[model samples]
Target: MELMGSMSVVEELREHYVAVVGSEPEYHEMRTRSGESVGVFEWPKGTSRMGVHLYASAGATRHGPGAREHAVELFLGVNTGSDAVKEGFANLILSVLKSNTVPQHGVFVAGNWKVIKGRKFTGWVLTERPDDLIPKLQLADGRHVVFLDALPVFPEEASYRRGNRSDELFEIWEESGLKSWDLDRDLPSVIERRSILRWPSWAQRNG
Candidate 1:
């Protein structure tokens, strides 16, 4: 075992996750009773249950040569929540995203199902395809994944560890220390409000 107890829950998750993505993890593919594929994933244990993320696409050209776009992310361990909060901790951040911090970043992220297999990246909702298109999702321990994901969307973006520390958004996430809500608010009400979901143009295009 990697002695996960010594590391913060978030750090532990990020480390294991990166390893899983690199190594030959325990892969799985789920199918319907009628023999249709539903979803798939590596099913690494101790998957992240709560997280914080900030993304601002200031555009690619705006950057000078040899520059990279920056994104900031944070995570909460499985035990990071309290009695009333628990897994719902992800929602607290959503409730506060627009009304307060990152005010213009109004769209709170929520995924209907995870693209656990075949797809290089996960999608909140499956891209429009034929009914026969293989279904994709992330399920583990007889459970399904449906929550606010706090990780940066791409490997190119910044996590608290490797990101630009001086960036204001990154600093906000770091200065919060652990979970942002912990330093200020106890926790906010669980809000399941609708957020505008964006999908790539290719998702809507014909093959």
Candidate 2:
């Protein structure tokens, strides 16, 4: 329960976000199925081309080994601007909060259905934004806020990653040469079926 003057942690984070990512984002306050409000900020095509969850980290605390003392915010990058994409990403982030689980970097979380319309993607591989696309922020209370890029993947890809090391799955993704950042890419599954022999090529490449 950290507050800065009269601004709460969420408000402070929002200010910090606008400072870093620019102040032109189309901000939306969405109501999840559970009736909880989550703030989303969307930057259109000319800008960051992403939608980020702002309030997800406020008040909620994470536990367990390797988990941060503070909570986390989630962001999803898009090749184009779409409200559907923003809402979908917001719902997913809210669901993670509802489940009481902290999304670790490079970890994969799968769902039974599609992530957004007109895409086969069904899950997320949470990781930090590369090349300082979005830098991690620290609150005045000394709590470092983490931002995770929720990279969407197909159901088979999700299943494959769950059975393998996070890095190994990452290798597969790198080898496949798909644009992992573009949620709206009209592409087939990088992986079709889960297999025990999935890493032979990865091993050879590393060996």
Candidate 3:
């Protein structure tokens, strides 16, 4: 199916995919069937078997020298895909909200999340910072998309406006640096880069 972005899509998916501060940080654990701890954010109702806990956002500011415009970052397992699409993660969340039509991914609206219920919570953070705790996703299509637990999302790179959608949507995760970093070594520098790998977005749609 062709991936498309539209205002209607955003309006349609907002309610279900929104990540509001839960009542309790300690109780907001997303547990698997075997009581395996997942994440701090609450899972969608009836979603017992979670594959991954995705943290995606668009319109976040870019890092390094040329840091004027916003950029997109998709964090799963050990990979960090930058400039995901001009549209960013909103489209993917919207698609996931649709459920049957798109892959099932768990995402939260990007914002400063120091406290869930007026308490300092290090368990779950909103803004990105790689080498932190994150999760993988079990999309609706029964696909397991893996990514790094820690995010490369930086405050300076965080967008003032909540990343919704930009002109570029179909572009998806076409960046080349998905697996170019060595998580075992340095994440920012270039060493013996790992062979390129497919993006979670690619597996979600093209699968």
| lDDT (Cα) of model 3 | 0.25
Per-candidate TM-scores read: 0.21, 0.73, 0.20
TM-score of decoy 3: 0.20
Residue pairs in candidate 2 whose N, alpha carbon or C atoms collide under 3 angstroms: none
What tens-digit string does per-residue lDDT give for candidate 3 at 1-207?
Answer: 212222232222222234221221111222222222211222322232223323332111222333222222233332222222111333333323233221112222323332112212111112232432333333332333233222222222223123532111111212324331222223223212222222233211211
Candidates 1 and 2, the one with greater lDDT = 2
Candidate 1 lDDT, tens digit per residue, 1-207?
A: 210111232233334444533433232222222232211122222342223111111110111233223211222222232322221222223222222222112122323222112122222111112231122222222221112223212111112123322243333444545343232322122212232223322121101
Candidate 1 worst ten-residue window by lDDT: 53-62
Segments in model 3 whose C-alpha atoms lie over 4 Å from true places? 1-76, 79-108, 114-152, 160-207
Report the poorest 10 consecutive residues by lDDT, candidate 3.
165-174
Q: Write the per-residue lDDT of candidate 2 for residues 64-179, one digit (tens) a residue.
A: 33445566777666566465666667656555655676566777766566666556666677877566566777777666767876777766667756555667667777776867
- Cα lDDT of model 2 overall? 0.57
Q: Rank the candidates by TM-score, best first.
A: 2, 1, 3
Model 1: how far is 205 from its true place, Å? 13
Model 3 residue 16 distance off true place after TM-score fit, in angstroms: 21
